[model samples]
Target: MISKDPRKGGLAGRVTKLSNSEQQNNPLHGVRLDAILEELVAKLGWEELGKKINIRCFNYDPSIKSSLAFLRKTPWAREKVEQLYLRTTKKGRK
Candidate 1:
């Protein structure tokens, strides 16, 4: 069946992808990984973040440049950082 929404002119159920505006609801949306790292380090500190995420980049000689390089190549680590960013920001607001 065709989608009633003109933005999605094709079949409705065929794909359930979110558009850019819809994705703004995501906490990480439009947030750069480097920015996320800086915030985490500022809020949690590298030692604490390493304890939480258990990654060498955060544990030893941690720097945003190095951490970002690692996170970019490693999906699992990047996901961890994004999750922590969301959690940290939520707590900050409350």
Candidate 2:
């Protein structure tokens, strides 16, 4: 049965997909993995994030090369950084 609504399923669910505006907020999207780490290090600072999160990457003067390698392999650390980014951005609004 053909639906009358033209918008029924034509990329309807894709609306939530990455838009250009949102793409700006995503540090990792379309970015080199090493670059993402560099930005995180620059913005958050390794010492501060290390103090807060107690992760090895932030603790040991870790390089973008090593951190990128670790984060790519470890889902849990990636999740932690994503969560931190969300929290940090949310706080910046106030």
Candidate 3:
């Protein structure tokens, strides 16, 4: 029997991970989730990052561990974070 839990693979019972070739051009390909969270926290602080993302993990009693757990299971939220990271870093390069 397959689990209906999203954390347990969701209704599909599995998730597809992108292959190396597929992520080759991605700036966040090799970036670890923890590192992303850490950098965002460092650069934006929980208050600003929370305001930007509007996520509970960043808004209330935020911590790297809690945020990581939430973001790992939540793809959309993770994507938002990665996009924010890219945008924030891009500005620094100029």
Output the lDDT of residue 75, model 3: 82
TM-score for candidate 2, residues paired by index: 0.55
Tens digits of per-residue lDDT, candidate 2, 1-94, equal 1124466744332334666887776655564556546666788888877876777877996777777788888878877876666566543344
- TM-score (C-alpha) between model 3 and the true structure: 0.74
Candidate order by TM-score, highest to lowest?
3, 1, 2
By TM-score, how accurate is candidate 1?
0.73
* lDDT: worst 10-residue window of model 3: 1-10
By the TM-score metric, which is better: model 2 or model 3? Answer: 3
- lDDT (tens digit, per residue) of candidate 3 on 1-94: 2336666565866456776787775777678889888988998999999999999999889999999999989889998998898888863344
Candidate 3 wrong stretches, greater than 4 Å: 1-21, 91-94
Q: What's each prediction's TM-score?
A: 0.73, 0.55, 0.74
Candidate 2 C-alpha error for residue 72, in Å: 0.8
Pairs in steric clash, model 1? none
Q: Model 2, which residues run further than 4 Å from truth? A: 1-35, 90-94
- Kindly give the number of clashing pairs for every candidate: 0, 0, 0
